[model samples]
Target: MNILHHAVLVKSVNITSVAKLLLDNLLRHVREHVASIGSLSTMTVATLLDPRFKTLGFLSRNKVQEAVRRLKSECTALIASSEASLPHPSDAGESTNNSSELWCLLDETVDQKRQSFNATADAILEVEQYLVEVNLRRHQDPLEYWHKQKHVYPYLYHMSQRFLCSPASSVPCKSVFSKAGRSSANEETAYNHKQ
Candidate 1:
């Protein structure tokens, strides 16, 4: 976001023709690729959940709220869908021919758990708790962190499995700067040849 903002607003007449051309192309490409942060909600939410870069990459408070809302929406949906798939208390007896004491106890436990379940409140609390915690070290592995936190935030653990496994894009942003370095080196080599 900073790079895009700087690229668009930057203007200087003293720069070489090559630099001016590069800056123009960067702005054009940024516009072509990223219309707005809204388009990357999945990436944004994933970053918000990341222990290391939770709020670092965001540009504004509004964007942070937007991403958090998106995550909450998805979290509730996931919890609802999973709950819907579970065998109901009454259905449990029908599935098993044995009317043993163990099955009866299990059904009672399931019923009690179901009665206490509050998906919305739990989701909000878990998300808030996650945000309140200190960020993990920069070098720490987020997957490892999430793995250890699986029991602490069960729904988020499942959601992270869905979001964090794959990257937002095949081409990461760091590679763009690497490509620019090569282009600058080429320009330097050509300039030396001209002399």
Candidate 2:
């Protein structure tokens, strides 16, 4: 397929939705890791508390106990919050099965992601503004300007790439080659050769 056609296909796929799907996958991975950590912590605690060897080092025992407590609390909290925030399994499954619907959903997701990106960009800009004002007031050298710019550079680049790939900017892949067929050079050459 041509570049334009490829772009059109990508645009049709609904990137925002794809990003959300990826985010969901990431969350699931994180949840599973948390659960595994919790289980490991519990096993560690059980092993430490076993009375088979009364000669265990005090520091090692204390460390294991502290780690178990912290891991249990943190993992429980993380799992609870993540589970609560996730979409219902049936809903997620349905979404996965419907490709066209997923495209619509993805558009919505992209919109939300864009809003989030904008907010982050604005906050970064505000910080830079604050720094500039402070430096100007204090008559300090603005040598740190580059440092401030660096913080927003990645976001700007991301936004640019996103905009370029968005449906509105995407053109059909066939258009790239189609233009050649419409060139006036061939017509001009034919007329001169006939003359």
Query: Top model by lDDT, which number?
Result: 1
For residues 90-177, write the lDDT of model 2, one tens digit per residue. Answer: 3343444578687768776775566555554454453334323322322332233333444544332322233223221112212322
lDDT of each: 0.71, 0.39
Q: Model 1 off-target regions past 4 Å?
A: 1-38, 90-117, 168-195
How far residue 28's Cα lies from its native spot in candidate 1, in Å, is: 9.0
**Top candidate (TM-score):** 1
176 Cα displacement, candidate 1 (Å): 5.9
Q: What does the lDDT come to for candidate 1?
A: 0.71
Clashing pairs in 2: 4-172, 4-173, 5-173, 17-106
